[model samples]
Target: MQGRSIPAPNDWAAQFWSPIVGAEAQATRETVAMYDMTALKRLEVTGPGAAAFLERLCTGKVAKSVGSVTYTLLLDHDGGIRSDITVARLARDRFQVGANGNLDLDWFSRHLPADGTVQVRDITPGTCCIGLWGPLARKVLQPLTDEDFSNEGLKYFRAKRAYIGSVPVTAMRLSYVGELGWELYTTADQGLKLWDTLWQAAKPLGGVIAGRGAFNSLRLEKGYRSFGTDMTYEHDPYEAGVGFAVKLDKDDFIGKAALQRRKSEVRRKLTCLTIDDPHSVVMGKEPVYDGGRAVGYVTSAAYGYTIGKGIAYAWLPAELAVPGTPVRIGYFDQRIEAVVAEEPLFDPTMSRLRG
Candidate 1:
């Protein structure tokens, strides 16, 4: 994503003004910030067997009710993650699928029954998403829609259709950051309009527009897993530390048997690691050492701006995944003092997002 514009249409002004107000910390503490997420493409799936087809392809129980959004993973036949996705049931036979790229349409198509029980349409060119994330997200957004935006009215992980200043939107009560936020989706033509509407609301609420730099830091602080980085097809759900997303008791999905067997034999796990040295920087692929032996490596790393520490996630042997387990992170030639930390170091109780 280097040198690529974030598709913040007509956002040159905000990009220029970020230096003045958006230091990221402001968004985390008091107000809301908008992140351009058009790079993460969306797909539309429809037909008679759309729900059944998805159920067979994912690792979680996909809901068939309209306006419900479910977080599920598409796993390979061997139980390895192919992609992580959020499926929003738009109609009885129609669904909107969100993924990291447009190419996932091919994967969705390839899994379709030869008899044409499902249809996949790539909607990236015509649609886009903007993540309005932070503590004051509701405060900034509630006035634009007649629909309720309160925590009680709109529960987390739910989706609702509403008009935000005349722009059609599908708002999902979800955020990568552990804060009260929403990911709003709209047509590409109206993307800038929606951004401007929210931007105007943010001005008085002390919120500022944040860029991808702040976006990454916010998510890392929340311990949100990055699919390709934190996990790959090489690791199973149990090993990836996202077993909560897998439901084996549901009807048999593609990777059910493999995941069920491996649950009992899980050898490695993904755990958060914090470097005792606050200034130490550990990009991905840094080897972790337990005593003198090499064990696992960091897949995702960033500074926890809120916690005032450097955090990283590594795949370690299950025995070494415990919190407070002493270890050393090899950052370049230097060994930084580190230890295993329980997931979601920033908001373990998740009061902020739920509030």
Candidate 2:
């Protein structure tokens, strides 16, 4: 794909917390809710060779069926993750990739072909996004669109174009918080209409506005990883416990060869742990101990409201990264007792998100 010059980012990210008002706990537990996702960069890949071009650039299969979304990674030459991204196949000739920053755009600039058969355009400034989450999300959104939003009609990881209250939008079924949710993406000009409409519909159904804090707690409860913090260029997929997302058998792509070799030889593996002391919450980067020695460290952590424990992720020796494996996490003056817990503490089966 031929890539365009990067567009300057909008200020929406700075406004995410300013206008929000309500108890964030309500957004996590029930109702349909909204989260300002404008901070994430969104880009469009289009033209004849869009799919094939992206297939070569990412670890996951990007030439997917239309209207589907794939969670994939852009890796360095040595199988280290450069960026984790989401690609939605909007149409036969169109794809949208979203991530936290400009790294993906830099990749495009370096690799996209000069020919016009494929093209990449940064759409971050012109687009805005808000997510509808929790149990009542579907119900609250159904009235605003003509499309079928029932479980059978709009399945997880699927995307489709529609309109909400006169604003054209693309809605995708996804869950970062382990609940039924749709992230509604709209043009910047229609952003206000989109948010107001969704908010108006959500009020009667018990929905509330959520900030980044709610997302932190919700995502941790679900064992979701934050790209730079939990999985990065220093950590391979196998060591990060996300090897399942890699398809090594596919036609050769970046990181394929190195990833294959590291698969079974992984010395350290990522896993979840829970602290017994609720008051001593670990906000991450704490040292983990085994037999009075520092064995590993935490990558991400938060208080999981649903599980009612301080949830954490750390890379430990493969043998110690097991359920009920006792350990200790050290802060300044305290060493909190902990146990390796099964991940996705809220819904291990993933039924809630699927529903």
Instruction: For residues 283-344, write the lDDT of model 1, one tens digit per residue.
Output: 78989999878898999886665676767889899999999898898866788888888878
Model 2, 1-355: lDDT tens digits are: 1122212222432212322222454454566678888778999999998988888888888787898999988888788888888999999999999876888798877887778788889999999999888888888888888888888988999999888878999998987888898888999999988899988998877677887876887888888889988887888888887776788867888888888877778888788999766566576788999979999999887666566666789878989998999999987777889899887788888887898
TM-score of predicted structure 1: 0.92
TM-score against truth, every candidate: 0.92, 0.91
Candidate 1 Cα outliers beyond 4 Å, as residue runs: 1-22
How far does residue 55 in candidate 1 sit from its true spot (Å)? 0.8
- lDDT value for candidate 1? 0.80
